[model samples]
Target: MKASLRLQDTAIRYFLEVAQIGSISEASVRLNVAPSAISRQISSLEDILGAVLFERQPRGMKLSAAGEMLAAYARKNALESARVVAEIDALNGIEKGHINIACSEGFAMDFIPRTLSNFRQQHPGIHFNLKVCAPAEVATLISRGDADIGITLSLSPTKDIKVEYRQPSPIMAVFHPTHPLAHKKTVSLSQLQPYPIALPEENTTVRQLFDICCSRLNLLFEPILESNHMASLSRFTAFGGGIHLSGEISMRHQIATEELIAVPIRDRGMDVRNIEIQTLSGRTLPNIIKVFLAYLIVKMKHEETIGF
Candidate 1:
């Protein structure tokens, strides 16, 4: 059979819903299909695709490797179909729907709130489910269809995830106002050598970037404290124990509150990973997600241009 003929819409949808819910019974409930119907459709889909989609477990079904690939394709196709319908609806001037997004805690706390608040005001009928997680976890959530959108620092792309937006945000040194280095408008990596530093834990992207930069400058970067959480890092910096490095946006509120001073590390060329907005490749975002992404792109561009 032809590849197109092998995958029917009903089968594809059943597979997609099952993948989303991670259980045949739950998918049946969500899609309003009988459990047997869902199972039969998924089995037919597996046969057509020439791969098993799920493995039975005592509690729930788990996706097999083949299932993951097919699920990604199914999600992309469903999203595209919805986008087409939304476009048709737009001709009648009716805007609607919800968007589920997964993002890192840093962006969730500072950047996303303002942008989403603005989006909600403009499209009150649209709903948002924002899940805050680490960058790797955010990527996994999007891959599993638990989230429609993801915002995170640039990393190696997963098989079908597309990087839609990448905004460069600088990593700046933060210190309490009373700290000696806080008086300097710009500091070099060498200037920080004398002070104890609070840094992200070793495996994180931020810590890796900081390590690479310091190594290039032949500067010693021994941290007195380390944490995976940005909030904790900021608190440590604010308490006057040690300096910390963080994204400019993540520390905006604390800086405004005068709890800490942010100094640009001019000589070290302190640039953090490119902030990215990602979606499954070949997919169309829902109207709410599409609009929110457009808004985010605009806001990030504005911030980039204005040096925020």
Candidate 2:
């Protein structure tokens, strides 16, 4: 018996590059092949797969329905290939595989670095690709299969994905150490009313929680400064500008090093939100991810029990 030759791998790789670049010519340039040769390969792929992979457009080529399906399969194959290569590299005691992660700016800045540093030390051959986006954007990236894992706060678990809830982190009100309310161990919602609050824009989980808390206390809760970035809020709060609200895990270092104080809000009943680890449903996690997630869970548990 003779072994079978397969163009599936080759075709999928070619189309992945083409889809990424959106132009056969550009893909050829990147692939170091002639434009005509790339075109021939695409045509051959289409014939072999018995479906058209791209729709010609005046600007460039777009993936057709069948093309989209193939592209998805190709992406999964690419990830699996990287995983296999990483496993092979691990035999040499090197961690040389790529992991793409999506997280919010706060987590990326404060938490992920230490975790990744430890992960890197343990698996020196692993490469990391990180994107810092809003929680909703992170969710979208995970759903679209662009990210292998997502970490976010206050996210409602959805059936579209599998979610592992980490320990909840308290959302606290932060102010400059010298501020009037800084002396208090806990602050009421009415006490926050005297100061201008700098908060994330409307529709964010943090903002929504803030609003509900304010409404319950019959406070207006108008923000003097609105931003999407938590770091900006931290900066503003550090300077004695206004009160800013964030998770205790996110503000731990800032509170310690920047002369900022975090007072827990008691009256409004704002509960801690669980930071979630999310992935596409039914997808088997690579060993690297499994190890990393285990580490994350352990670390989060420690953080939850110990004040940061």
Candidate 3:
């Protein structure tokens, strides 16, 4: 777009800094540049665009009418610039970059860490920032540019969000290997009625499925312990006590080690849903991120096909 052509990258940076912090001095401290240098850049930008970008006040600067319009263009340009930098680095056979991810707590437990470790073996210089969030917030985080990618269950499609990959990720009954129903490979809603249970909070997708299935089977649902944290639920299930309901992937490590067991909740399609890999729509991703994303997608697809 012609939006970024109005000013040099430095000028756009300076203008954005002032607009964000509402003060040149604050932005200078953050940018590690002199205040006067930032001021001169802002002045030059305004002159070039022939629009007043800020309104100076005794308190602090504020965005003018023109400033708001430039803000979108400036941030988009900056993100594109970062993409360009990463691509240039790739040309030299370098795979160094930092990627931020926001995802569901379920993926945070096992899938993400394992994937990150595997990917980094090929590009040790690549770093990752992972944050646990609800599935519903995944699209928002990517669209708002808070994260490079999102991995979450039951992620809804949106206009500004692109689904890179999605696969079946159903809720399951998780408990200790020594538990009564542990010998069984799968369980029905009726089977869980007799056990003391640890359930995720009602807001979570796992709990929502549990509630819906129980209602369909005319079963009463009660939990001895309810929490939003997967680790807490995992630890509870690790001990010799109640069965905790969760997605199979969240506790796959424990299941593999025999610290816990995961049994699918039985139904024709009761817990049917997808785990989605997502990104901001129409944004060109950095090569480093693209590489990692491709690996993640293929790995996840493999999991779906073979229960990895």
In order of appearance, the predictions have TM-scores of 0.77, 0.75, 0.77
Instruction: Give lDDT tens digits, candidate 1, residues 1-308.
Output: 67666788888878877776788889888998899998898888777777788998888898899887777777666667777887777777877776888988788767888888887788887778999887777777776667888988764656668888887766788889999889797888888889999998765667777888888888887789988788888887777789998777787677778888888887544674678888876676766577778888898888778766
RMSD of each: 4.2, 4.4, 5.1
> How well does candidate 2 match the true structure in TM-score terms?
0.75
Clashes by residue pair, model 3: none
Model 3 lDDT tens row, 1-308: 35346568788778887887899999999999999999999988888778898999999999898987787566666678889998998899876899999999989998899899998888899989998887888776675566899998872466577888877777788878888898897888788889999888866788777777677777896789888888998898787768888878888788788898888887755567788888877788998888889999988888777774
Estimate the lDDT of model 2.
0.77
Score candidate 3 by TM-score against the native: 0.77
Worst 10 residues of 1 by lDDT: 265-274
- Among these predictions, the greatest lDDT belongs to 3
Off-target runs (Cα >4 Å) in candidate 2 are 1-74, 215-218, 267-269
User: Residue 265 lDDT in model 1?
Assistant: 80
Candidate 3: worst-modelled 10 consecutive residues by lDDT: 1-10
